[model samples]
Structure formats: C-alpha cells, structure tokens
Target: MTSPQAAPLANAGPALHAPLLASAQIVFAQVSINFGAALAKGLFVSLAPEQVAALRSGIAALLLLALVRPWRRRAAFSRRDIGWCALYGLALGGMNLMMYAAFERIAIGIACAIEICGPLAVVLLTTRRPRDFAWLALAIGGLVLLMPWPGRAHASDPVGIALALGAAACWALYIMLGRRAARVGAPNAVAIGMVAACLVTVPAGLARGLPALDAPVLALAATVAVLSSALPYVLEMRAMGQLPSRVVGLISSAGPATAALIGFVVLGEALGPWQWLAIAVLVTASAGCSLGTAPPVSKLREEPLT
Candidate 1:
C-alpha cells in the first residue's frame, strides 16, 4: 500500500493560501500608493514638490515611530544594523524627493511608469526564465505606448524624465537596502529607517516654511502620509521579506495602470483609448505571472517586530 504521504492531496495546507495572500498584499500596496498620489496632486498647487515630500516623509516617520516604539527595543540591533537602516532611510528620502519633483513636471502615471524602470531593471537582471522576459516585455510595451513620447510631437519635459530616472535609481537602492533592513526584523528596522529619512526631509521643510503644518494642509498631508508613505512601506517591506525581489518587481508592474486610473478619477486626467488598451495589457501581464510558485513556504514565517 502507498504511504499516506505518497498520495497527492487535492488541496494541502497553506499551498493555496500563502501566494494568494502575498499577491493581495502587492495589489493593496499599489492601490494605497496611487490614491495617496491623487491626494498629493491636490496639494501641489499650494506647496512645492520638495515641501510636500518633507511633509509626507516627516509625518509618516512620526506615525511609524509612534506605532512601532522603536525606542523600547533599541538594544537589539548592532552597529551594522544601524548603518543599514540609515542608508535605507536615505534612499527612501531621495526616492520621495525625486518622485515629487518628477510629479510636478509630468503626469502621475507617466512619472510612475518611469520610476518603475529601476525595479524592472533589477528583475530583468536577476531573472533567468524566458517566460519572465516575455512578461516583462509585454508590461514594458504597454508603458512605452502609454508615455507621450517626444517624437509624438508633444515632448515630455526632459528634466522630469531625468528626475524619474533618479527616483528609479533611488528605488533600486531602496529595494536593496530594504531587503537588508528586513533581516533586522520589523518595527525596529522600519521605524529607525524612517527616522533617518525624516532627518533629510524635515530640515528641508523647515527651510521652506513648513507649509504642511498649516491647519488646512496638515490634514491632507496626514492622509497622504498614511496611505502613501506609511502603508506602502510597511506592506511592501512585509512582502519583500516573503517574496523574491524579481517576483515582487514583476507584480508591481501593474502600478502604472493603477496610477492612471487614480489620476483619471481624482484629477480628471483622461486616458485615450490606446492608453486604456495599454492598461489592459499591463493587467494581463501581471496576471500571467507565476505568483503561486514564486514565493516558497519558508517565506511565510514572518519575524514579529518584537
């Protein structure tokens, strides 16, 4: 008789659950970030991009500090840990600054699409499968079509594209440092890194007269902090620890479409029919990924903040 273990189970344990949950985590992160972007655009008319970055970063740092209370467990991390967190924070700050700068000069979806080039490069370099290449090509094709190229006679601002590229570089560094920081475990690592980020941003805001502190602006900034800075960092960090960077990067390719939809809704930034078709291709590409088999079971064991 065959051993019980020898039999193939129709559905077994967390085999079905873990990847689905991981995919959901990624999708939720994309949604939260773009909604936050929409809110940010409303404030751009009142505040400069750098000023907005300072506000969002500072508020997010404060919120994360309160929730994590990293002060209580300060002794857990080594000097090396501290260094990694510092660098991680710096990368995040740079990314924020670059993205906001790009946003001021470009459309939301376009800036987001350009910023994604960083992570997409990381994924392409690390991946070996031809299938992964096909997926990446499809997603990228959609993005290229969506972007209003210079040759199309409506040249996008070169400075804006440059800033987006800078943000992409920062994002690549952020992802690398983020993975290292994740090993330092939850709240302590994230909280400390955010503090470092605050150092970069808060000072800039003070120099700019701290517009985010005004009564009317403060509320919106707080919401932006929650949805964009706080939620995405926390959620993405969690998922990064569980999934391979390439897999996470591939899944995040849906970001442009998500941003486009949010921009269309909140800012009335309408997309042409071709843009809609591009969005559909992005969706199809992200869906076609092997999400179920990408992250192994070992990844599911999260290290608590404690």
Candidate 2:
C-alpha cells in the first residue's frame, strides 16, 4: 500500500480523487479570475494599477473576514502554521502587486504569457515523468510564440516584462505555499493570507490612488474583488476538494488562453493565427489532463488554490 502522500502521485486510492478535483477547480479559478480582471481593467482605466490592486485586495479581505473570521479560530493554528500562512499571504500580495505592475506596461495577453512561467516551473520541478515533459514543452513553446520574441527592433518595456516574470515566480511560490496552507484548511488559510495581502495592498493603493478610490471607483473595485477574488476563491476551494493536484496544475495552464479570450471578447483585442495556435496548444493540454481523470466523489475536502 502507498503512503497517503505518495497516493497523489499515482492513482493509489480515494486520495487520488482530491488531486483530480483540485485540477478541475484550477480551471474554474483561473477562468473566473481572467474574466473578472478583464471587467475590472475597463472600470479601472482611470485608476493606477496600485489603486486597482488595493481595491481588489481590500474588498477580498472584507469578504474573507466575513466568511472565515480568522480571529475566531486563531487558537486552532500552531505557530508554525501561522508562520506559513503569513508567508503565503505575503507571497500572494507580492504576486498581485507585481502582476498589476506588469499589466501596466504590456498587453494583458503578453503579460499573462510571461506569468505562466511560474506554474510551469513548478510542474517541471516536481515531476520526473517523461510524458509530463511534453506538456511542459508545449507550454513553453506556446509561450515563446505568444511572447514578443522579436528582437530589439520591436520590443515592449523590458522592465515590465521582467516584472511579469517576477510575478510568475511569485505565483509558483504562491502555489507551493498555498498547497501547504491548504493542509491547514483552505478557507482559514486564505482568509489569513488575504488579511496579509490586504495590509500590503490597501496602504499602497491609498498612497498612490487616493483620488481614484472615490464612490464610483470604490463600487467598481468592490465588484472586481467579488468577481476576481472572493467568488473564484470560494468556488475553487470547493472544486479543489474534489480534484487532484496534477490535474489541477494541468488545467491551470489554460489561464493564458482564457486571459486572451477575455481580452478579445471584452477588451476588443485580436489574435493572429499563430497566437490562436498557441492558445489551442495550451487549452488542449489542459483539457487533456482533465479528461484523463474522473470526477471527484466529494466536495468537502480542501484542495490546492494555485
């Protein structure tokens, strides 16, 4: 018999179900986030990226507070768990801040393509399976096609590109940390982390986007928070409980493609044939992963939120 931890690697037992569900939840989570971000981007055109991030995090914090009331269960966590949660929250905040910064300088699709590196790295690092490398290669090749691999003759902001990649690294870290935190319970860990992210973003937004956070913008930001963070977080937690991590990670590779679609449909962006092909590669890889697994049996167990 396999140890419970090893169970997730192979289709060992009922535990394999959790990773499978986690995979599906990951798709739902990324799609929801991309769509919500698209909506928020329009509403936040007048606002600075910092301001928008602040509003998103602040609103998410309030919703999480209302939902989990972390203070009410503080005694439940050990000091080590508390430390891990805090680190997780900080990573979350940093990732968001950096991603918004990236978006400010590049096209949304381009920025997302850069950010994809984070999770892809995670997938590469953990697996020794040769078959999985094909997916990894597909993801990388797709990213190369999506990125402005053109020389200096036609380049965007290098700093912005760097920031987007940084966000990707933080994203990968966030996933790893989130999985650890999920072991501490998704809702509680997320709530605690949001509080930390809130601390990081709210102040920065206030400092940078004070004028933009007035009534109308505040309302828009609130909506963005609900759409981009709270709702997705809730749904993802539910989905993760029923999915597997490998499947979840694989599905999440579709994030860039979803972001591209959101940009096209909502933001009037267009894609060429090669770009569309890249999207196809990513989506097919992700969907193939999901299809390979069966539906999970339960919705109560917590799953990965990355």
| Number of backbone-clashing residue pairs for each candidate, in the order shown | 0, 14
lDDT of each candidate versus the true structure: 0.71, 0.69
Error of 1 at 156 (Å): 3.0
Error of 1 at 136 (Å): 5.6
How would you encode candidate 1's per-residue C-alpha lDDT over 140-224 as one tens digit per residue? 8866765666555444577887897798788777767767786677567778887887777767767868563578898998999
Off by over 4 Å in 1: 1-26, 128-155, 206-212, 232-251, 273-306
Instruction: Record all residue pairs in model 1 with backbone atoms less than 3 Å apart, i.e. clashing.
Output: none
Best of the candidates, lDDT? 1
Report RMSD for candidate 1. 5.6
Global lDDT of model 2: 0.69
> Tens digit of lDDT per residue, candidate 2, span 1-306?
788887667755656666656565666778778877776677657888877887788788889889888778777778888778878888888888888887777556666766766655665566566655776677667666656666523344678878988887887777788767766687888888887887677777788845534688778778788878887777776765464544554556567778878888988767677667766775554444333333331111122232
